[model samples]
Target: MIRMIIPLAIFLGLVALLLVSLETAEQRKLVASPLIGRPVPNFTLPGLHDPDVQRSSADLQGEPYIINVWGSWCWACREEHPYIERLGNESGIPLVGFNWKDERQDALRWLNQFGDAWTFHMVDFEGRAAIDLGVYGAPETFLVDHEGIIRHKHIGPVDQTVFEDLMRRIMEMRSEAES
Candidate 1:
Protein backbone atom coordinates (compact mmCIF):
# COMPACT_ATOMS: atom_id res chain seq x y z
CA MET A 1 0.00 0.00 0.00
CA ILE A 2 1.07 3.67 -0.43
CA ARG A 3 1.23 4.25 3.33
CA MET A 4 3.51 1.23 3.86
CA ILE A 5 5.87 2.36 1.04
CA ILE A 6 6.20 5.89 2.53
CA PRO A 7 7.39 4.57 5.91
CA LEU A 8 9.72 2.02 4.30
CA ALA A 9 11.18 4.72 2.05
CA ILE A 10 11.73 7.00 5.05
CA PHE A 11 13.53 4.24 6.94
CA LEU A 12 15.76 3.43 3.96
CA GLY A 13 16.60 7.13 3.51
CA LEU A 14 17.58 7.47 7.16
CA VAL A 15 19.78 4.39 6.95
CA ALA A 16 21.46 5.72 3.82
CA LEU A 17 22.06 9.10 5.50
CA LEU A 18 23.61 7.39 8.48
CA LEU A 19 25.94 5.36 6.27
CA VAL A 20 27.00 8.45 4.32
CA SER A 21 27.55 10.47 7.49
CA LEU A 22 29.68 7.75 9.01
CA GLU A 23 31.75 7.56 5.84
CA THR A 24 32.43 11.30 5.78
CA ALA A 25 32.82 11.99 9.51
CA GLU A 26 35.80 10.75 11.49
CA GLN A 27 35.14 9.11 14.81
CA ARG A 28 36.65 10.89 17.80
CA LYS A 29 39.21 8.72 19.56
CA LEU A 30 42.14 9.17 21.94
CA VAL A 31 45.29 8.12 20.12
CA ALA A 32 48.16 6.98 22.37
CA SER A 33 51.68 7.37 21.02
CA PRO A 34 55.10 8.44 22.25
CA LEU A 35 56.76 10.68 19.67
CA ILE A 36 58.81 12.66 22.17
CA GLY A 37 58.55 15.03 25.14
CA ARG A 38 55.40 13.67 26.80
CA PRO A 39 55.06 12.96 30.52
CA VAL A 40 54.67 9.22 30.96
CA PRO A 41 51.62 7.96 32.82
CA ASN A 42 52.84 7.42 36.38
CA PHE A 43 52.14 4.17 38.19
CA THR A 44 53.11 2.09 41.22
CA LEU A 45 52.46 -1.61 40.81
CA PRO A 46 53.45 -4.81 42.63
CA GLY A 47 56.82 -6.30 41.81
CA LEU A 48 56.93 -9.74 40.24
CA HIS A 49 60.17 -10.68 41.97
CA ASP A 50 58.73 -9.29 45.18
CA PRO A 51 54.96 -9.33 45.69
CA ASP A 52 55.00 -7.65 49.09
CA VAL A 53 56.82 -4.69 47.51
CA GLN A 54 55.74 -2.14 44.91
CA ARG A 55 57.69 -0.40 42.18
CA SER A 56 57.08 3.33 42.21
CA SER A 57 57.26 5.44 39.08
CA ALA A 58 58.91 8.00 41.31
CA ASP A 59 61.91 5.67 41.66
CA LEU A 60 62.57 6.18 37.97
CA GLN A 61 63.36 9.79 38.85
CA GLY A 62 66.90 11.30 38.94
CA GLU A 63 68.07 9.28 35.92
CA PRO A 64 67.14 8.43 32.37
CA TYR A 65 65.84 4.88 32.27
CA ILE A 66 64.50 2.19 29.96
CA ILE A 67 61.26 0.54 31.06
CA ASN A 68 60.12 -2.56 29.19
CA VAL A 69 56.72 -4.25 29.47
CA TRP A 70 56.81 -7.95 28.74
CA GLY A 71 55.29 -11.34 29.58
CA SER A 72 56.13 -15.00 29.20
CA TRP A 73 52.83 -15.49 27.32
CA CYS A 74 54.08 -13.34 24.44
CA TRP A 75 56.14 -15.00 21.67
CA ALA A 76 57.93 -11.78 20.78
CA CYS A 77 58.92 -11.46 24.39
CA ARG A 78 60.61 -14.84 24.22
CA GLU A 79 62.45 -13.81 21.09
CA GLU A 80 63.51 -10.50 22.60
CA HIS A 81 64.52 -11.70 26.05
CA PRO A 82 68.19 -12.10 25.23
CA TYR A 83 68.35 -8.66 23.65
CA ILE A 84 66.54 -7.26 26.65
CA GLU A 85 69.21 -8.89 28.78
CA ARG A 86 71.86 -7.25 26.67
CA LEU A 87 70.26 -3.87 27.09
CA GLY A 88 69.74 -4.31 30.79
CA ASN A 89 73.27 -5.43 31.31
CA GLU A 90 74.99 -3.03 28.94
CA SER A 91 72.94 0.06 28.33
CA GLY A 92 74.22 3.21 29.97
CA ILE A 93 70.68 4.10 31.06
CA PRO A 94 69.04 2.32 33.96
CA LEU A 95 66.86 -0.62 32.87
CA VAL A 96 63.58 -1.59 34.49
CA GLY A 97 60.94 -4.18 33.61
CA PHE A 98 57.18 -4.45 33.84
CA ASN A 99 56.30 -8.16 33.78
CA TRP A 100 52.77 -7.81 32.48
CA LYS A 101 49.59 -9.83 32.91
CA ASP A 102 50.90 -13.31 33.59
CA GLU A 103 50.86 -16.13 36.06
CA ARG A 104 52.81 -15.34 39.18
CA GLN A 105 54.51 -18.69 39.40
CA ASP A 106 55.29 -18.76 35.67
CA ALA A 107 56.78 -15.23 35.79
CA LEU A 108 59.02 -16.08 38.69
CA ARG A 109 59.99 -19.31 36.99
CA TRP A 110 60.84 -17.54 33.74
CA LEU A 111 63.16 -15.10 35.43
CA ASN A 112 64.79 -17.95 37.31
CA GLN A 113 65.26 -20.06 34.18
CA PHE A 114 66.47 -17.33 31.84
CA GLY A 115 67.76 -14.42 33.93
CA ASP A 116 66.52 -11.35 35.74
CA ALA A 117 67.60 -8.75 33.22
CA TRP A 118 65.60 -6.01 34.90
CA THR A 119 66.93 -3.95 37.76
CA PHE A 120 63.59 -4.75 39.40
CA HIS A 121 60.56 -6.10 37.58
CA MET A 122 57.01 -5.04 38.39
CA VAL A 123 54.39 -7.77 38.29
CA ASP A 124 51.34 -6.39 36.47
CA PHE A 125 48.73 -9.08 36.89
CA GLU A 126 45.39 -8.93 34.98
CA GLY A 127 46.90 -6.09 32.89
CA ARG A 128 44.54 -3.40 34.33
CA ALA A 129 47.49 -1.16 35.21
CA ALA A 130 49.22 -1.83 31.91
CA ILE A 131 46.02 -0.87 30.07
CA ASP A 132 46.00 2.45 31.90
CA LEU A 133 49.58 2.95 30.68
CA GLY A 134 48.31 2.40 27.08
CA VAL A 135 49.93 -1.01 26.71
CA TYR A 136 48.69 -2.96 23.68
CA GLY A 137 51.07 -5.89 23.93
CA ALA A 138 54.20 -7.25 25.53
CA PRO A 139 57.79 -6.30 24.63
CA GLU A 140 56.95 -2.60 24.44
CA THR A 141 59.60 -0.28 25.81
CA PHE A 142 59.38 3.29 27.04
CA LEU A 143 62.44 5.48 27.40
CA VAL A 144 62.02 7.90 30.27
CA ASP A 145 64.16 10.80 31.38
CA HIS A 146 65.40 12.04 34.76
CA GLU A 147 62.18 14.04 35.24
CA GLY A 148 60.11 10.83 34.92
CA ILE A 149 58.88 11.94 31.51
CA ILE A 150 58.61 9.50 28.59
CA ARG A 151 61.16 10.45 25.96
CA HIS A 152 60.39 7.71 23.43
CA LYS A 153 58.61 4.37 22.94
CA HIS A 154 59.42 1.25 20.95
CA ILE A 155 56.51 -1.03 20.18
CA GLY A 156 58.30 -4.21 19.10
CA PRO A 157 61.50 -6.21 19.54
CA VAL A 158 64.47 -3.87 19.63
CA ASP A 159 67.77 -4.97 18.18
CA GLN A 160 71.19 -3.40 18.49
CA THR A 161 70.54 -0.94 15.67
CA VAL A 162 67.32 0.35 17.16
CA PHE A 163 68.96 0.45 20.55
CA GLU A 164 71.90 2.36 19.16
CA ASP A 165 69.68 4.95 17.50
CA LEU A 166 67.50 5.55 20.56
CA MET A 167 70.48 5.74 22.90
CA ARG A 168 72.15 8.21 20.57
CA ARG A 169 69.08 10.40 20.52
CA ILE A 170 68.64 10.24 24.28
CA MET A 171 72.27 11.13 24.79
CA GLU A 172 71.86 14.10 22.48
CA MET A 173 68.75 15.21 24.33
CA ARG A 174 70.47 14.85 27.69
CA SER A 175 73.46 16.81 26.53
CA GLU A 176 71.20 19.56 25.22
CA ALA A 177 69.17 19.68 28.45
CA GLU A 178 72.28 19.88 30.64
CA SER A 179 73.81 22.73 28.59
Candidate 2:
Protein backbone atom coordinates (compact mmCIF):
# COMPACT_ATOMS: atom_id res chain seq x y z
CA MET A 1 0.00 0.00 0.00
CA ILE A 2 2.86 2.46 0.81
CA ARG A 3 4.64 1.72 -2.51
CA MET A 4 1.41 2.34 -4.42
CA ILE A 5 0.95 5.72 -2.61
CA ILE A 6 4.50 6.87 -3.56
CA PRO A 7 3.81 6.45 -7.28
CA LEU A 8 0.45 8.21 -6.92
CA ALA A 9 2.10 11.14 -5.15
CA ILE A 10 4.73 11.52 -7.87
CA PHE A 11 2.04 11.63 -10.55
CA LEU A 12 0.10 14.29 -8.64
CA GLY A 13 3.20 16.42 -8.22
CA LEU A 14 3.89 16.29 -11.97
CA VAL A 15 0.33 17.33 -12.67
CA ALA A 16 0.66 20.29 -10.34
CA LEU A 17 3.84 21.46 -12.08
CA LEU A 18 2.18 21.21 -15.47
CA LEU A 19 -0.80 23.21 -14.22
CA VAL A 20 1.42 26.04 -13.01
CA SER A 21 3.42 26.12 -16.24
CA LEU A 22 0.28 26.28 -18.34
CA GLU A 23 -1.11 29.09 -16.23
CA THR A 24 2.00 31.25 -16.69
CA ALA A 25 2.67 30.62 -20.39
CA GLU A 26 2.56 34.28 -21.37
CA GLN A 27 4.88 35.34 -18.57
CA ARG A 28 7.39 32.68 -19.60
CA LYS A 29 7.69 34.26 -23.04
CA LEU A 30 9.25 37.41 -21.55
CA VAL A 31 12.38 35.59 -20.30
CA ALA A 32 14.29 38.05 -18.11
CA SER A 33 17.64 39.29 -19.39
CA PRO A 34 20.59 39.15 -17.04
CA LEU A 35 22.19 42.22 -18.62
CA ILE A 36 19.71 44.59 -17.07
CA GLY A 37 21.42 47.41 -15.12
CA ARG A 38 24.77 46.31 -16.51
CA PRO A 39 26.88 48.05 -19.08
CA VAL A 40 26.49 47.24 -22.78
CA PRO A 41 29.02 44.64 -23.90
CA ASN A 42 31.97 46.19 -25.66
CA PHE A 43 31.97 45.46 -29.37
CA THR A 44 33.13 47.06 -32.60
CA LEU A 45 31.36 45.72 -35.61
CA PRO A 46 31.20 46.90 -39.21
CA GLY A 47 28.29 48.87 -40.57
CA LEU A 48 25.82 46.84 -42.58
CA HIS A 49 25.71 49.29 -45.45
CA ASP A 50 29.39 50.02 -45.42
CA PRO A 51 31.66 47.33 -44.03
CA ASP A 52 34.64 49.68 -43.91
CA VAL A 53 32.80 51.82 -41.36
CA GLN A 54 32.78 50.52 -37.78
CA ARG A 55 30.45 51.25 -34.86
CA SER A 56 31.39 50.65 -31.25
CA SER A 57 29.61 50.59 -27.91
CA ALA A 58 31.85 53.39 -26.68
CA ASP A 59 30.54 55.70 -29.39
CA LEU A 60 26.97 55.28 -28.09
CA GLN A 61 27.73 56.69 -24.65
CA GLY A 62 25.95 59.79 -23.24
CA GLU A 63 22.51 59.09 -24.76
CA PRO A 64 19.63 56.69 -24.31
CA TYR A 65 19.12 54.30 -27.19
CA ILE A 66 17.74 50.95 -28.31
CA ILE A 67 19.79 48.09 -29.65
CA ASN A 68 17.72 45.64 -31.68
CA VAL A 69 19.25 42.25 -32.44
CA TRP A 70 17.97 40.81 -35.67
CA GLY A 71 18.83 38.74 -38.71
CA SER A 72 17.42 38.83 -42.21
CA TRP A 73 16.63 35.16 -41.82
CA CYS A 74 14.41 35.62 -38.78
CA TRP A 75 10.68 35.79 -39.49
CA ALA A 76 10.00 37.40 -36.09
CA CYS A 77 12.39 40.18 -36.98
CA ARG A 78 10.26 40.86 -40.03
CA GLU A 79 7.20 40.99 -37.78
CA GLU A 80 8.82 43.54 -35.44
CA HIS A 81 10.42 45.78 -38.07
CA PRO A 82 7.38 48.00 -38.48
CA TYR A 83 7.21 48.87 -34.82
CA ILE A 84 10.94 49.50 -34.76
CA GLU A 85 10.54 51.86 -37.67
CA ARG A 86 7.80 53.69 -35.84
CA LEU A 87 10.06 54.14 -32.83
CA GLY A 88 12.94 55.37 -34.95
CA ASN A 89 10.70 57.84 -36.77
CA GLU A 90 8.82 59.12 -33.74
CA SER A 91 10.52 58.28 -30.44
CA GLY A 92 13.43 60.74 -30.72
CA ILE A 93 15.66 57.92 -29.50
CA PRO A 94 18.44 56.47 -31.57
CA LEU A 95 17.85 52.88 -32.69
CA VAL A 96 20.88 50.71 -33.33
CA GLY A 97 20.33 47.68 -35.52
CA PHE A 98 22.52 44.78 -34.49
CA ASN A 99 22.50 42.26 -37.32
CA TRP A 100 23.64 38.89 -36.01
CA LYS A 101 24.95 35.85 -37.88
CA ASP A 102 23.69 37.03 -41.24
CA GLU A 103 25.02 37.52 -44.68
CA ARG A 104 25.91 41.19 -45.22
CA GLN A 105 24.26 41.48 -48.60
CA ASP A 106 21.10 39.81 -47.42
CA ALA A 107 20.89 42.16 -44.44
CA LEU A 108 21.27 45.19 -46.68
CA ARG A 109 18.64 43.89 -49.03
CA TRP A 110 16.25 43.27 -46.18
CA LEU A 111 16.62 46.84 -44.90
CA ASN A 112 16.22 48.22 -48.41
CA GLN A 113 13.07 46.18 -48.95
CA PHE A 114 11.62 46.68 -45.48
CA GLY A 115 12.37 50.40 -45.07
CA ASP A 116 15.37 51.27 -42.95
CA ALA A 117 14.34 52.61 -39.53
CA TRP A 118 17.54 52.24 -37.58
CA THR A 119 19.75 55.25 -36.90
CA PHE A 120 22.59 52.95 -37.88
CA HIS A 121 23.34 49.25 -38.41
CA MET A 122 26.11 46.94 -37.19
CA VAL A 123 26.88 43.50 -38.52
CA ASP A 124 27.96 40.52 -36.36
CA PHE A 125 28.69 37.95 -39.01
CA GLU A 126 30.28 35.42 -36.66
CA GLY A 127 28.00 36.06 -33.65
CA ARG A 128 30.88 36.64 -31.20
CA ALA A 129 29.38 39.89 -29.91
CA ALA A 130 26.01 38.17 -29.59
CA ILE A 131 27.48 35.68 -27.12
CA ASP A 132 28.65 38.52 -24.90
CA LEU A 133 25.16 40.03 -25.04
CA GLY A 134 23.68 36.69 -23.85
CA VAL A 135 21.64 36.36 -27.00
CA TYR A 136 19.39 33.32 -27.22
CA GLY A 137 18.09 34.06 -30.67
CA ALA A 138 17.18 36.76 -33.14
CA PRO A 139 14.78 39.68 -32.55
CA GLU A 140 16.02 40.42 -29.04
CA THR A 141 16.04 44.09 -28.02
CA PHE A 142 17.88 46.04 -25.36
CA LEU A 143 17.04 49.46 -23.94
CA VAL A 144 20.14 51.30 -22.83
CA ASP A 145 20.12 54.44 -20.72
CA HIS A 146 22.26 57.57 -21.15
CA GLU A 147 25.10 56.18 -19.07
CA GLY A 148 25.38 53.15 -21.40
CA ILE A 149 23.70 50.78 -18.95
CA ILE A 150 21.16 48.28 -20.23
CA ARG A 151 17.85 49.12 -18.57
CA HIS A 152 15.50 46.54 -20.10
CA LYS A 153 15.49 43.64 -22.50
CA HIS A 154 12.80 41.90 -24.51
CA ILE A 155 13.47 38.40 -25.77
CA GLY A 156 11.01 38.13 -28.60
CA PRO A 157 9.28 40.05 -31.38
CA VAL A 158 8.03 43.48 -30.33
CA ASP A 159 4.40 43.51 -31.34
CA GLN A 160 2.06 46.47 -30.84
CA THR A 161 1.63 45.74 -27.14
CA VAL A 162 5.36 45.36 -26.63
CA PHE A 163 5.93 48.56 -28.58
CA GLU A 164 3.67 50.46 -26.24
CA ASP A 165 5.48 48.99 -23.26
CA LEU A 166 8.84 50.06 -24.71
CA MET A 167 7.56 53.58 -25.35
CA ARG A 168 6.24 53.82 -21.83
CA ARG A 169 9.60 52.75 -20.44
CA ILE A 170 11.37 55.37 -22.53
CA MET A 171 9.00 58.06 -21.33
CA GLU A 172 9.50 56.99 -17.73
CA MET A 173 13.25 57.10 -18.16
CA ARG A 174 13.11 60.59 -19.64
CA SER A 175 10.86 61.91 -16.90
CA GLU A 176 13.03 60.35 -14.24
CA ALA A 177 16.11 62.01 -15.68
CA GLU A 178 14.47 65.41 -15.99
CA SER A 179 13.55 65.40 -12.32
Candidate 3:
Protein backbone atom coordinates (compact mmCIF):
# COMPACT_ATOMS: atom_id res chain seq x y z
CA MET A 1 0.00 0.00 0.00
CA ILE A 2 1.00 3.71 -0.24
CA ARG A 3 1.45 3.89 3.52
CA MET A 4 3.99 1.03 3.54
CA ILE A 5 5.85 2.54 0.54
CA ILE A 6 6.07 5.97 2.23
CA PRO A 7 7.76 4.53 5.33
CA LEU A 8 10.23 2.53 3.23
CA ALA A 9 11.09 5.59 1.12
CA ILE A 10 11.78 7.70 4.22
CA PHE A 11 14.03 5.00 5.71
CA LEU A 12 15.96 4.63 2.47
CA GLY A 13 16.48 8.38 2.20
CA LEU A 14 17.81 8.52 5.76
CA VAL A 15 20.20 5.66 5.00
CA ALA A 16 21.44 7.42 1.89
CA LEU A 17 22.08 10.62 3.82
CA LEU A 18 24.02 8.72 6.42
CA LEU A 19 26.09 7.04 3.74
CA VAL A 20 26.99 10.39 2.15
CA SER A 21 27.96 11.85 5.48
CA LEU A 22 30.18 8.89 6.22
CA GLU A 23 31.84 9.17 2.84
CA THR A 24 32.85 12.77 3.42
CA ALA A 25 33.90 12.36 7.05
CA GLU A 26 37.63 12.62 6.34
CA GLN A 27 37.18 15.78 4.31
CA ARG A 28 35.04 17.24 7.08
CA LYS A 29 37.77 16.57 9.64
CA LEU A 30 39.89 19.28 8.01
CA VAL A 31 37.97 22.24 9.35
CA ALA A 32 39.86 25.42 8.55
CA SER A 33 41.37 27.13 11.58
CA PRO A 34 40.43 30.78 12.19
CA LEU A 35 44.14 31.51 12.71
CA ILE A 36 44.85 31.11 9.01
CA GLY A 37 46.17 34.34 7.50
CA ARG A 38 46.77 35.73 10.99
CA PRO A 39 50.11 36.31 12.64
CA VAL A 40 51.48 33.56 14.83
CA PRO A 41 50.40 33.90 18.43
CA ASN A 42 53.07 35.45 20.64
CA PHE A 43 54.57 33.12 23.22
CA THR A 44 57.84 32.61 25.06
CA LEU A 45 58.14 28.94 25.84
CA PRO A 46 61.17 27.18 27.26
CA GLY A 47 63.18 24.72 25.22
CA LEU A 48 62.10 21.12 25.54
CA HIS A 49 65.61 19.75 25.86
CA ASP A 50 66.78 22.61 28.06
CA PRO A 51 64.16 24.50 30.01
CA ASP A 52 66.66 27.22 30.87
CA VAL A 53 66.71 28.40 27.26
CA GLN A 54 63.68 30.24 25.89
CA ARG A 55 62.29 30.65 22.37
CA SER A 56 59.71 33.20 21.35
CA SER A 57 57.55 33.98 18.37
CA ALA A 58 59.43 37.25 17.95
CA ASP A 59 62.61 35.32 17.22
CA LEU A 60 60.97 33.36 14.38
CA GLN A 61 59.42 36.46 12.74
CA GLY A 62 61.69 36.89 9.76
CA GLU A 63 61.56 33.36 8.40
CA PRO A 64 58.86 31.01 7.18
CA TYR A 65 58.52 28.06 9.50
CA ILE A 66 56.24 25.27 10.66
CA ILE A 67 54.75 24.94 14.13
CA ASN A 68 53.80 21.36 14.90
CA VAL A 69 51.73 20.94 18.05
CA TRP A 70 52.09 17.49 19.52
CA GLY A 71 52.16 15.62 22.79
CA SER A 72 54.05 12.51 23.81
CA TRP A 73 50.81 10.76 24.70
CA CYS A 74 49.22 11.14 21.31
CA TRP A 75 49.19 8.01 19.11
CA ALA A 76 48.27 10.02 16.04
CA CYS A 77 51.44 12.01 16.53
CA ARG A 78 53.41 8.78 16.38
CA GLU A 79 51.78 7.88 13.10
CA GLU A 80 52.75 11.23 11.58
CA HIS A 81 56.29 11.38 12.92
CA PRO A 82 57.99 10.07 9.81
CA TYR A 83 56.29 12.62 7.58
CA ILE A 84 57.15 15.37 10.03
CA GLU A 85 60.72 14.14 9.97
CA ARG A 86 60.70 14.36 6.20
CA LEU A 87 59.34 17.89 6.33
CA GLY A 88 62.03 18.96 8.72
CA ASN A 89 64.90 17.35 6.83
CA GLU A 90 63.78 17.96 3.26
CA SER A 91 61.44 20.92 3.19
CA GLY A 92 64.18 23.48 3.80
CA ILE A 93 61.81 25.24 6.17
CA PRO A 94 62.59 25.51 9.83
CA LEU A 95 60.25 23.47 11.98
CA VAL A 96 59.36 24.47 15.52
CA GLY A 97 58.38 21.47 17.58
CA PHE A 98 55.75 22.72 20.00
CA ASN A 99 55.56 20.03 22.64
CA TRP A 100 52.12 20.68 24.06
CA LYS A 101 50.89 19.73 27.50
CA ASP A 102 53.34 16.94 28.11
CA GLU A 103 55.80 15.91 30.76
CA ARG A 104 59.29 17.09 29.87
CA GLN A 105 60.89 13.70 30.35
CA ASP A 106 58.32 11.87 28.29
CA ALA A 107 58.64 14.33 25.43
CA LEU A 108 62.37 13.92 25.43
CA ARG A 109 62.09 10.14 25.61
CA TRP A 110 59.71 10.08 22.66
CA LEU A 111 62.06 12.25 20.65
CA ASN A 112 65.04 10.12 21.52
CA GLN A 113 63.28 6.92 20.47
CA PHE A 114 61.86 8.41 17.28
CA GLY A 115 64.65 10.82 16.37
CA ASP A 116 64.18 14.56 16.73
CA ALA A 117 63.53 16.40 13.46
CA TRP A 118 62.83 19.86 14.72
CA THR A 119 64.86 22.94 14.02
CA PHE A 120 63.78 24.14 17.46
CA HIS A 121 62.07 22.27 20.23
CA MET A 122 59.93 24.31 22.62
CA VAL A 123 57.72 23.13 25.45
CA ASP A 124 54.26 24.28 26.43
CA PHE A 125 53.71 22.36 29.64
CA GLU A 126 50.32 23.99 30.28
CA GLY A 127 49.08 24.36 26.69
CA ARG A 128 48.18 28.04 27.19
CA ALA A 129 50.08 29.08 24.08
CA ALA A 130 48.38 26.32 22.09
CA ILE A 131 45.02 27.72 23.13
CA ASP A 132 46.00 31.10 21.70
CA LEU A 133 47.02 29.31 18.48
CA GLY A 134 43.58 27.54 18.31
CA VAL A 135 44.93 24.03 18.57
CA TYR A 136 42.22 21.37 18.76
CA GLY A 137 44.51 18.44 19.31
CA ALA A 138 47.93 16.95 18.70
CA PRO A 139 49.51 16.63 15.23
CA GLU A 140 48.25 20.00 14.02
CA THR A 141 50.65 21.84 11.73
CA PHE A 142 50.65 25.53 10.95
CA LEU A 143 52.77 26.88 8.11
CA VAL A 144 53.88 30.43 8.75
CA ASP A 145 55.03 32.70 5.94
CA HIS A 146 58.16 34.84 5.97
CA GLU A 147 56.39 37.75 7.65
CA GLY A 148 55.14 35.42 10.43
CA ILE A 149 51.63 35.16 9.03
CA ILE A 150 50.08 31.72 9.22
CA ARG A 151 49.45 30.58 5.67
CA HIS A 152 48.04 27.08 6.13
CA LYS A 153 46.86 24.70 8.83
CA HIS A 154 46.61 20.93 8.64
CA ILE A 155 44.61 19.09 11.22
CA GLY A 156 45.34 15.47 12.11
CA PRO A 157 48.14 13.31 10.75
CA VAL A 158 50.29 14.43 7.87
CA ASP A 159 50.68 11.57 5.40
CA GLN A 160 52.28 11.46 1.94
CA THR A 161 49.55 13.48 0.21
CA VAL A 162 49.44 16.01 2.99
CA PHE A 163 53.22 16.25 2.95
CA GLU A 164 53.19 16.93 -0.79
CA ASP A 165 50.56 19.62 -0.37
CA LEU A 166 52.53 21.26 2.43
CA MET A 167 55.70 21.17 0.33
CA ARG A 168 53.87 22.79 -2.55
CA ARG A 169 52.48 25.49 -0.30
CA ILE A 170 55.91 26.15 1.19
CA MET A 171 57.37 26.53 -2.27
CA GLU A 172 54.59 28.92 -3.23
CA MET A 173 55.21 31.00 -0.13
CA ARG A 174 58.93 31.17 -0.89
CA SER A 175 58.25 32.32 -4.43
CA GLU A 176 55.80 34.90 -3.17
CA ALA A 177 58.45 36.24 -0.81
CA GLU A 178 61.01 36.39 -3.58
CA SER A 179 58.81 38.69 -5.64
Best by TM-score: 3
lDDT of each: 0.78, 0.90, 0.91
lDDT of 3 by residue, 1-179 (tens): 99899999999999999999999998988777888988988999999888999989989987788999899999999999999999999888899999999999899899999999999888998889888999988989999999999999999999999999999999888787778
Distance from true position, residue 154, model 3, in Å?
0.7
Whole-model alpha-carbon lDDT for candidate 3? 0.91
Decide which is better by TM-score, 1 or 2. Answer: 2
Model 1, which residues run further than 4 Å from truth? 1-36, 173-179
User: Scored by Cα lDDT, where does model 2 land?
Assistant: 0.90
What RMSD does each model have against the real structure?
7.5, 3.0, 2.3
By descending TM-score, how would the candidates be arranged?
3, 2, 1
> For candidate 3, which ten residues in a row score worst on lDDT?
170-179
Model 3, runs deviating above 4 Å: 1-15
Clashes of each: 1, 0, 0
Query: Candidate 1 vs candidate 3: which has greater lDDT?
Result: 3
Clashing pairs in 3: none
TM-score of each: 0.74, 0.87, 0.88
